[model samples]
Target: MTKKIYWAAVIYTILGLLGGLYYRELTKAKNFTGETQLAILHTHLLALGTLVFLIVLVLEKVFALSETKSFKPFFWSYHAGMVITVGGMAVHGTLTVLGKESGGAIAGIAGLGHIILTVAFVLLFAGLYARISDKQPVKAA
Candidate 1:
Protein backbone atom coordinates (compact mmCIF):
# COMPACT_ATOMS: atom_id res chain seq x y z
CA MET A 1 0.00 0.00 0.00
CA THR A 2 2.80 2.40 0.77
CA LYS A 3 4.42 1.56 -2.52
CA LYS A 4 1.13 2.11 -4.27
CA ILE A 5 0.65 5.46 -2.60
CA TYR A 6 4.17 6.57 -3.46
CA TRP A 7 3.75 5.55 -7.06
CA ALA A 8 0.40 7.27 -7.24
CA ALA A 9 2.03 10.49 -6.01
CA VAL A 10 4.80 10.16 -8.57
CA ILE A 11 2.33 9.60 -11.37
CA TYR A 12 0.24 12.57 -10.33
CA THR A 13 3.31 14.82 -10.22
CA ILE A 14 4.26 13.77 -13.72
CA LEU A 15 0.71 14.36 -14.90
CA GLY A 16 0.61 17.76 -13.22
CA LEU A 17 3.84 18.79 -14.94
CA LEU A 18 2.51 17.54 -18.22
CA GLY A 19 -0.72 19.40 -17.72
CA GLY A 20 1.22 22.64 -17.19
CA LEU A 21 3.23 22.05 -20.32
CA TYR A 22 0.13 21.26 -22.31
CA TYR A 23 -1.67 24.36 -21.12
CA ARG A 24 1.29 26.61 -21.90
CA GLU A 25 1.92 25.20 -25.34
CA LEU A 26 -1.74 25.02 -26.26
CA THR A 27 -2.50 28.60 -25.29
CA LYS A 28 0.68 29.88 -26.90
CA ALA A 29 -0.09 28.09 -30.11
CA LYS A 30 -3.50 29.73 -30.21
CA ASN A 31 -2.30 33.09 -28.87
CA PHE A 32 -4.97 33.06 -26.18
CA THR A 33 -4.58 35.93 -23.74
CA GLY A 34 -7.67 35.96 -21.62
CA GLU A 35 -8.37 33.68 -18.66
CA THR A 36 -9.59 30.20 -19.42
CA GLN A 37 -10.25 27.02 -17.51
CA LEU A 38 -7.00 25.60 -18.85
CA ALA A 39 -5.11 28.09 -16.71
CA ILE A 40 -6.17 26.14 -13.61
CA LEU A 41 -5.57 22.58 -14.76
CA HIS A 42 -1.95 22.61 -13.67
CA THR A 43 -2.68 23.82 -10.19
CA HIS A 44 -5.63 21.51 -9.75
CA LEU A 45 -3.64 18.46 -10.73
CA LEU A 46 -0.64 19.40 -8.61
CA ALA A 47 -2.52 20.43 -5.51
CA LEU A 48 -5.29 17.86 -5.60
CA GLY A 49 -3.46 14.99 -7.23
CA THR A 50 0.21 15.17 -6.38
CA LEU A 51 0.08 17.03 -3.11
CA VAL A 52 -2.93 15.17 -1.75
CA PHE A 53 -1.48 11.78 -2.54
CA LEU A 54 1.86 12.72 -1.00
CA ILE A 55 0.10 13.74 2.18
CA VAL A 56 -1.89 10.52 2.10
CA LEU A 57 1.33 8.56 1.84
CA VAL A 58 2.58 10.09 5.07
CA LEU A 59 -0.73 9.46 6.77
CA GLU A 60 -0.71 5.87 5.60
CA LYS A 61 2.78 5.43 7.03
CA VAL A 62 1.59 6.67 10.38
CA PHE A 63 -1.96 5.30 10.40
CA ALA A 64 -1.89 2.36 8.00
CA LEU A 65 -5.02 3.70 6.41
CA SER A 66 -5.19 1.00 3.80
CA GLU A 67 -5.83 -1.53 6.52
CA THR A 68 -9.23 -0.02 6.93
CA LYS A 69 -11.95 -1.16 4.55
CA SER A 70 -12.92 2.41 3.88
CA PHE A 71 -9.55 3.07 2.31
CA LYS A 72 -10.30 0.96 -0.75
CA PRO A 73 -13.61 2.61 -1.40
CA PHE A 74 -12.10 6.03 -0.80
CA PHE A 75 -9.25 5.33 -3.16
CA TRP A 76 -11.41 4.25 -6.07
CA SER A 77 -13.98 6.97 -5.55
CA TYR A 78 -11.33 9.67 -5.30
CA HIS A 79 -9.73 8.59 -8.55
CA ALA A 80 -13.08 8.43 -10.29
CA GLY A 81 -13.91 11.92 -9.09
CA MET A 82 -10.57 13.29 -10.18
CA VAL A 83 -10.93 11.77 -13.62
CA ILE A 84 -14.35 13.28 -13.98
CA THR A 85 -13.29 16.68 -12.66
CA VAL A 86 -10.08 16.96 -14.62
CA GLY A 87 -11.80 15.66 -17.71
CA GLY A 88 -14.39 18.36 -17.38
CA MET A 89 -11.68 20.97 -17.03
CA ALA A 90 -9.88 19.74 -20.12
CA VAL A 91 -13.06 19.67 -22.17
CA HIS A 92 -14.28 23.04 -21.00
CA GLY A 93 -10.89 24.60 -21.43
CA THR A 94 -10.43 23.20 -24.91
CA LEU A 95 -13.84 24.46 -25.95
CA THR A 96 -13.03 27.86 -24.48
CA VAL A 97 -9.74 27.99 -26.31
CA LEU A 98 -11.51 27.06 -29.51
CA GLY A 99 -14.07 29.80 -28.90
CA LYS A 100 -16.83 27.29 -28.56
CA GLU A 101 -19.51 27.82 -25.97
CA SER A 102 -20.33 24.97 -23.64
CA GLY A 103 -23.84 25.09 -22.35
CA GLY A 104 -24.37 23.62 -18.84
CA ALA A 105 -23.39 19.97 -19.14
CA ILE A 106 -19.76 20.65 -18.30
CA ALA A 107 -20.65 22.46 -15.13
CA GLY A 108 -22.99 19.68 -14.08
CA ILE A 109 -20.38 17.06 -14.69
CA ALA A 110 -17.83 18.97 -12.70
CA GLY A 111 -20.27 19.42 -9.88
CA LEU A 112 -20.84 15.69 -9.72
CA GLY A 113 -17.11 15.18 -9.58
CA HIS A 114 -16.82 17.54 -6.66
CA ILE A 115 -19.60 15.73 -4.89
CA ILE A 116 -17.79 12.44 -5.27
CA LEU A 117 -14.59 13.97 -4.00
CA THR A 118 -16.44 15.24 -0.94
CA VAL A 119 -17.79 11.77 -0.24
CA ALA A 120 -14.33 10.30 -0.60
CA PHE A 121 -13.01 12.80 1.93
CA VAL A 122 -15.64 11.75 4.39
CA LEU A 123 -14.68 8.12 3.94
CA LEU A 124 -11.01 8.85 4.49
CA PHE A 125 -11.61 10.91 7.58
CA ALA A 126 -13.98 8.31 8.97
CA GLY A 127 -11.40 5.61 8.53
CA LEU A 128 -8.67 7.76 10.02
CA TYR A 129 -10.82 8.66 12.97
CA ALA A 130 -11.68 5.06 13.61
CA ARG A 131 -8.04 4.05 13.50
CA ILE A 132 -7.09 6.80 15.92
CA SER A 133 -9.91 5.91 18.24
CA ASP A 134 -8.77 2.31 18.38
CA LYS A 135 -5.23 3.39 19.19
CA GLN A 136 -6.19 5.68 22.07
CA PRO A 137 -4.94 4.51 25.48
CA VAL A 138 -7.41 5.24 28.27
CA LYS A 139 -6.07 7.16 31.21
CA ALA A 140 -6.88 6.13 34.78
CA ALA A 141 -9.58 8.26 36.30
Candidate 2:
Protein backbone atom coordinates (compact mmCIF):
# COMPACT_ATOMS: atom_id res chain seq x y z
CA MET A 1 0.00 0.00 0.00
CA THR A 2 2.84 2.37 0.78
CA LYS A 3 4.45 1.60 -2.54
CA LYS A 4 1.15 2.00 -4.28
CA ILE A 5 0.54 5.38 -2.69
CA TYR A 6 4.07 6.50 -3.45
CA TRP A 7 3.69 5.46 -7.07
CA ALA A 8 0.40 7.29 -7.27
CA ALA A 9 2.12 10.43 -6.06
CA VAL A 10 4.85 10.02 -8.62
CA ILE A 11 2.35 9.53 -11.42
CA TYR A 12 0.40 12.57 -10.39
CA THR A 13 3.53 14.67 -10.18
CA ILE A 14 4.44 13.72 -13.73
CA LEU A 15 0.87 14.40 -14.86
CA GLY A 16 0.90 17.77 -13.14
CA LEU A 17 4.09 18.75 -14.87
CA LEU A 18 2.63 17.68 -18.19
CA GLY A 19 -0.52 19.62 -17.50
CA GLY A 20 1.52 22.77 -16.89
CA LEU A 21 3.41 22.25 -20.10
CA TYR A 22 0.21 21.69 -22.02
CA TYR A 23 -1.28 24.86 -20.60
CA ARG A 24 1.70 26.96 -21.55
CA GLU A 25 2.04 25.58 -25.04
CA LEU A 26 -1.68 25.61 -25.76
CA THR A 27 -2.11 29.15 -24.58
CA LYS A 28 0.85 30.21 -26.64
CA ALA A 29 -0.51 28.49 -29.73
CA LYS A 30 -3.90 30.09 -29.25
CA ASN A 31 -2.44 33.45 -28.31
CA PHE A 32 -4.76 33.43 -25.33
CA THR A 33 -3.82 36.13 -22.88
CA GLY A 34 -6.87 35.85 -20.65
CA GLU A 35 -7.45 33.47 -17.79
CA THR A 36 -8.52 29.88 -18.34
CA GLN A 37 -9.19 26.76 -16.31
CA LEU A 38 -6.03 25.21 -17.73
CA ALA A 39 -4.02 27.51 -15.53
CA ILE A 40 -5.35 25.76 -12.42
CA LEU A 41 -5.37 22.14 -13.59
CA HIS A 42 -1.64 21.79 -12.97
CA THR A 43 -1.87 23.01 -9.40
CA HIS A 44 -5.00 21.00 -8.70
CA LEU A 45 -3.37 17.73 -9.81
CA LEU A 46 -0.21 18.48 -7.86
CA ALA A 47 -1.95 19.50 -4.67
CA LEU A 48 -4.85 17.07 -4.70
CA GLY A 49 -3.14 14.14 -6.37
CA THR A 50 0.58 14.17 -5.63
CA LEU A 51 0.64 15.94 -2.29
CA VAL A 52 -2.47 14.26 -0.92
CA PHE A 53 -1.14 10.82 -1.79
CA LEU A 54 2.15 11.58 -0.05
CA ILE A 55 0.25 12.59 3.07
CA VAL A 56 -1.77 9.41 2.88
CA LEU A 57 1.44 7.43 2.55
CA VAL A 58 2.63 8.90 5.83
CA LEU A 59 -0.69 8.24 7.52
CA GLU A 60 -0.62 4.66 6.36
CA LYS A 61 2.82 4.26 7.93
CA VAL A 62 1.57 5.64 11.23
CA PHE A 63 -1.82 3.94 11.36
CA ALA A 64 -1.67 0.98 9.02
CA LEU A 65 -4.58 2.74 7.39
CA SER A 66 -4.77 0.31 4.49
CA GLU A 67 -6.03 -2.35 6.89
CA THR A 68 -9.03 -0.23 7.76
CA LYS A 69 -12.32 -1.10 6.13
CA SER A 70 -12.89 2.34 4.67
CA PHE A 71 -9.43 2.70 3.19
CA LYS A 72 -10.26 0.91 -0.04
CA PRO A 73 -13.42 2.88 -0.58
CA PHE A 74 -11.61 6.13 0.14
CA PHE A 75 -8.84 5.27 -2.30
CA TRP A 76 -11.20 4.46 -5.16
CA SER A 77 -13.41 7.43 -4.48
CA TYR A 78 -10.46 9.79 -4.39
CA HIS A 79 -9.17 8.56 -7.73
CA ALA A 80 -12.58 8.67 -9.34
CA GLY A 81 -13.18 12.18 -8.12
CA MET A 82 -9.79 13.33 -9.26
CA VAL A 83 -10.22 11.91 -12.76
CA ILE A 84 -13.65 13.41 -13.17
CA THR A 85 -12.54 16.78 -11.86
CA VAL A 86 -9.42 16.94 -14.00
CA GLY A 87 -11.22 15.72 -17.11
CA GLY A 88 -13.88 18.35 -16.72
CA MET A 89 -11.31 21.06 -16.27
CA ALA A 90 -9.38 19.99 -19.33
CA VAL A 91 -12.48 19.94 -21.50
CA HIS A 92 -13.77 23.23 -20.17
CA GLY A 93 -10.42 24.88 -20.61
CA THR A 94 -10.04 23.59 -24.14
CA LEU A 95 -13.46 24.87 -25.04
CA THR A 96 -12.66 28.24 -23.52
CA VAL A 97 -9.42 28.48 -25.43
CA LEU A 98 -11.21 27.58 -28.65
CA GLY A 99 -13.73 30.36 -27.98
CA LYS A 100 -16.56 27.96 -27.48
CA GLU A 101 -19.24 28.42 -24.88
CA SER A 102 -19.85 25.65 -22.39
CA GLY A 103 -23.07 24.86 -20.60
CA GLY A 104 -23.72 24.35 -16.90
CA ALA A 105 -23.47 20.58 -17.25
CA ILE A 106 -19.69 20.70 -17.30
CA ALA A 107 -19.61 22.77 -14.16
CA GLY A 108 -22.09 20.45 -12.49
CA ILE A 109 -20.02 17.42 -13.36
CA ALA A 110 -16.93 19.04 -11.94
CA GLY A 111 -18.93 19.85 -8.79
CA LEU A 112 -19.88 16.23 -8.52
CA GLY A 113 -16.20 15.40 -8.42
CA HIS A 114 -15.76 17.79 -5.53
CA ILE A 115 -18.69 16.21 -3.72
CA ILE A 116 -17.14 12.77 -4.10
CA LEU A 117 -13.88 14.08 -2.75
CA THR A 118 -15.67 15.44 0.31
CA VAL A 119 -17.21 12.06 1.03
CA ALA A 120 -13.85 10.36 0.61
CA PHE A 121 -12.30 12.76 3.07
CA VAL A 122 -14.96 11.88 5.62
CA LEU A 123 -14.26 8.18 5.13
CA LEU A 124 -10.52 8.71 5.64
CA PHE A 125 -11.06 10.66 8.83
CA ALA A 126 -13.47 8.07 10.12
CA GLY A 127 -10.91 5.35 9.54
CA LEU A 128 -8.16 7.38 11.14
CA TYR A 129 -10.28 8.12 14.18
CA ALA A 130 -11.16 4.48 14.53
CA ARG A 131 -7.51 3.55 14.44
CA ILE A 132 -6.62 6.12 17.08
CA SER A 133 -9.48 5.27 19.39
CA ASP A 134 -8.81 1.57 19.17
CA LYS A 135 -5.35 1.96 20.63
CA GLN A 136 -4.95 0.92 24.27
CA PRO A 137 -3.50 3.46 26.62
CA VAL A 138 -0.22 2.84 28.44
CA LYS A 139 -0.50 1.82 32.11
CA ALA A 140 1.15 3.91 34.83
CA ALA A 141 1.94 1.30 37.47
Candidate number of the best TM-score: 2
Model 2 shows how many backbone clashes?
0
- lDDT for model 2 comes to 0.90
Q: What is the lDDT of residue 89 in candidate 1?
A: 90
lDDT of 2 by residue, 44-115 (tens): 999999999999999988888888888899999999999999989988998898899878999999999999
Cα miss at 137, model 2 (Å)?
A: 11
Clashing pairs in 2: none
Regions of model 2 farther than 4 Å from truth: 135-141
Write down the TM-score of every candidate. Answer: 0.93, 0.93
Alpha-carbon deviation at 9 in model 2, angstroms: 0.5
lDDT of 1 by residue, 28-110 (tens): 99998877888898888889888999999988878888888789999889998988898899889988988899779998998
Q: In model 1, what is the error at residue 90, expressed in angstroms?
A: 0.7
